[model samples]
Target: MGEGAWSCQQSPAILLAMPAQPASSLPNGVVQSEATARALIDAVVSNELSAFRQGPLSPAELAAQTQQPVYRALRCIRKWEKMGVLRVHSVHKRAGRPIRRYALSAPSFFIPAQVLPLEDVAGIVSRPLEQQLHAHVAHALREVVGLQGSEVFLEPRRYGAFLVSAPGQVWDGSGENLPVLANRWATLKLSYADACAMRDELDEVFARYADRAGPQTYWLHLRLVPETSKA
Candidate 1:
């Protein structure tokens, strides 16, 4: 192996002790920026449960796999933990030092599993406005084109920029904690709250985007998902 090549596995302490690697090894499409990398890490953690399902991968493993710094990975993980998106399992003794493993707290009771994975959703947010608009319009076209799919979209005129959200799946609980939602004129990220909150938020935004509640009108599909097909 070349100097840059990493061993398949190592103790947490040993892994941490090794120098940081350059960003070149990340998956082809990964963004090179740290801010972007942090978001990518969030996307990764949100969609896939921790590797063992017992808890999240060790901090070392995350850094190794993502090629991000240990502190950077931990920072993003900590934020999600605060948002109740994840939880830390008990600290363990590894390489004779304390190692903390994190894990998803619960299947975001907020969105259903069938909804598009968060990585896909994040991909949508990370795109340029023109691209986002194009993607949104394309989704609406699906119904016209006879394609089977669901999409979440938003138009933010008063807020200065339009927001669109689309998902690959529309399972139950998909709307919870969504990054973009608007009602009439107000907007906010989806939160853990009453269904009335969701309706109020959606309705208010729709009033602005859609002239009326009728079908022909256009309103952002904040969280449209198809029911899971029972196999």
Candidate 2:
């Protein structure tokens, strides 16, 4: 854990104590505009990727199994492939038949492990199955690619199995109302040092959209998977 990395058990008190502190101390571009964060969170929490696995699926099956429209699902699938989150293996097939199966590549992280707790992260989903799988993948992507916090998931593993925890003091004042906003911050492309300087502005942005400072607790998990094997 880093300077802001505390446990959920005492996050509220830590948050209040640090209220006067400037958000500028956070990593560069770590927080985002409130509106964008909310959009990202909504897209994530309501997404049907929880239902998808690194397996074969017919076009009809893919359409029926996901919560998103076929177009969006197709688009997301392609994006995941490009991001190295999914590996599409071309299985040998009969002539004239299209290959229709994919294997997920072990995930790779764009950041360092010090950025997040890879061993304790959980998915955004509520069910055990989703939490174990899709949730992990979602959090990893959100941590690495989204805004609030910056992290990169390193390897293959189910969500929440490793690297899940609250944000501690980072988003302490925000509860359910802050995920989307936080995600936006993570997605922004700022350096860690510059991001720390804008914390107050980020907090204020959240305040404007929040309904009564909804439950103060750290719930953001910054997890990263390493690219190379460690001894």
Candidate 3:
């Protein structure tokens, strides 16, 4: 078989029946950004394409479903195929021309923090859902007196997720006893193994509460980085 070509002997039924694998389970499943990755995933899991989610699709079919030009669709599929995010499920001969059909190599992808450009990060925060979150947080802070000059904003980071800042002191509506917002920075010295252990422990703590039923929602962000120089 030629490169990128698949034989018809591979059962389409078996391929379609295989369960979608998570990004962590597949090599090359981690991406730097969600741009093309998110769109492809949506194409697979979206209700509009429910009938074909499990099966492979031709570039023309993907173009129609994604509302992109056929050439562009083919180019994207080929690029993803090179990245190992997609693979040829089969090729069909139509009118003596071979048409390639592709399927996602994995259904899910993971994008590491700080991998997106600054503008892309800004674009994400500008989306409707994030805008709503900002509005809600702002309204709640407005009732608290000491936060008059305080503002919550994103701090661009070179090595991790954007750091959210609400600099200076923040007080609850009562205005005296304890602060409602917590922001702390600490310098730690630890062996590599100890650091990894600490991170694993924190992951467990986050996972423990990740799916708990609750009346209120809270956002928590954490980062652990090695210090390179004194500021």
Candidate 4:
């Protein structure tokens, strides 16, 4: 841990705080984005409820986890309710006030692009592509290979990268947040929404590079995996 470097010295339950995503009125599955897909995939794979279901959560409960304003949380709750994705689990009169608790009708009721854990084994299963990213990446790799006498991949150190992790973990979310040596691998923990924005922004950067007329090639690789797994 050098100066300004972050060390994973926090708890596993230490959550990543985020501002509310301005509760939207769209129906489930209507406003699909990579973030939504990622969250859905995460929830399914975890076999656990999302923060939204930290036990029949009220808007306040959701707000607590999301760090969203209470009003925004209420808007999101109402939207899901109207979509019939959530059901009133119970209502109680507490200290002269009524409180409502809502539960997801089914885990899959509102999730987008779901694949059951049993059906989602990456190496053992072959999934049909939902888009062209895989095909295009393969095409690009072949084209790079065919070009003769190219300096595209010279200086291996410029492209050097590796993983650092405990043997049984996908990632330690508690990893450092402060700036560190750029020469080392960077570990990040981001909310689904933030992750989505990073993906889109990076795509834009790559698009700009593709439009340039020169041959200064680069390779960037990233892998995202969950934090915990085991028997």
Question: Among these predicted structures, which one has the highest TM-score?
Answer: 3
Better of 2 and 3 by lDDT: 3
Return the candidate ranking by lDDT, descending. 3, 4, 1, 2
Score every model by TM-score.
0.30, 0.28, 0.39, 0.31
For model 3, residues 156-225, the per-residue Cα lDDT tens digits are 5322222222443333234464225444456788999998888788768866876677876665545576
Q: Report the poorest 10 consecutive residues by lDDT, candidate 2.
A: 14-23
Clashing pairs in 3: none
The candidate scoring highest on lDDT is: 3
lDDT of each: 0.43, 0.38, 0.54, 0.44
On residues 1-231, what C-alpha lDDT tens digit does candidate 1 reach at each position? 111111111111211122222222233323334444344333433332234233356778777766779887777677655544456665897687789876655432222223435444444433443364556666644434223444543445222332323244323323433323223343344444654466666557744654344545332424322234772
TM-score of 1: 0.30
Instruction: Rate residue 64 of model 2 by lDDT.
Output: 70
The CA lDDT at 221 in model 3 is 46
Off by over 4 Å in 3: 1-55, 60-71, 82-85, 94-99, 104-146, 151-169, 172-183, 189-197, 211-220, 229-231
**Model 2 lDDT tens row, 119-223:** 322221223334444465565446443235533444454112222243321333233433433332233555556565455555555445544556643244333
Candidate RMSDs in Å, in order, are 19.9, 22.0, 13.0, 18.2
Question: Positional deviation of 188 in candidate 1, in angstroms?
Answer: 34
- Model 3, residue 124: C-alpha shift (Å): 16
